[model samples]
Target: MSSLAKQLTGVVANTRKLLDLCGSLQAENDMLKLEVQSLKVAVDTSIDKNKQLEEKVKALTVARSLDEVEVGEAGINEKILDTKQKINDFVREIDKCIELLK
Candidate 1:
């Protein structure tokens, strides 16, 4: 019965070690989850800032196009059409960026 007792003690010690390791892993997992949450928030903030910047760019493009429109008819029409295409391309790019983030 002495040998049996030693074997049981060993088993108990190993069980304790396993439990400790599991607890530490769980803690690390929780820390990683929090970090992921923070990173997601950061990404969201960056996306919002990018959207604001895009809006500013679009407005500036329009304003500049209008200023150039006073230069007269023939070439101004072409410039306006080019500006519209650029705006469309920018919109599509923003959509792609949003999809990538998601």
Candidate 2:
């Protein structure tokens, strides 16, 4: 009877230890799951912000292109004005030559 009692006591002690280990593992699992959820939320927010930033960059690129086109048009207009001035000068010279001949 004494030997049987010792065996039973050892078995009960081992069972308690196992139960404690299981409880600790369960708590750790819960904490890890919560952490994973938090990380997921943070990642999603970053993705959204990145998309918005990309859109803004695209809009800026388009605006810059439009500005370049406008500047080019202004340069073309200046060239046209210079050409018109030269033409006017030539006409004056032609009139002077005609008057002298007459």
TM per candidate comes to 0.69, 0.66
* Candidate-wise lDDT, in order: 0.90, 0.79
Cand. 2 TM to true fold: 0.66
Highest lDDT scorer: 1
Off by over 4 Å in 1: 71-102
- Across 24-87, the per-residue lDDT of candidate 2 in tens digits comes to 9999999999999999999999998997897577556545544555357787676566556655
Itemize residue pairs with steric clashes in candidate 1: none
Residue-wise C-alpha lDDT for candidate 1, range 1-102, written one tens digit per residue: 999999999999999999999999999999999999999999999999998997898889777876776566878888888888887988998799899999
Estimate the overall C-alpha local distance difference test score of candidate 1. Answer: 0.90
Clash-forming residue pairs, model 2: none
- Model 2 worst lDDT run, 10 consecutive residues: 62-71
Clashes of each: 0, 0
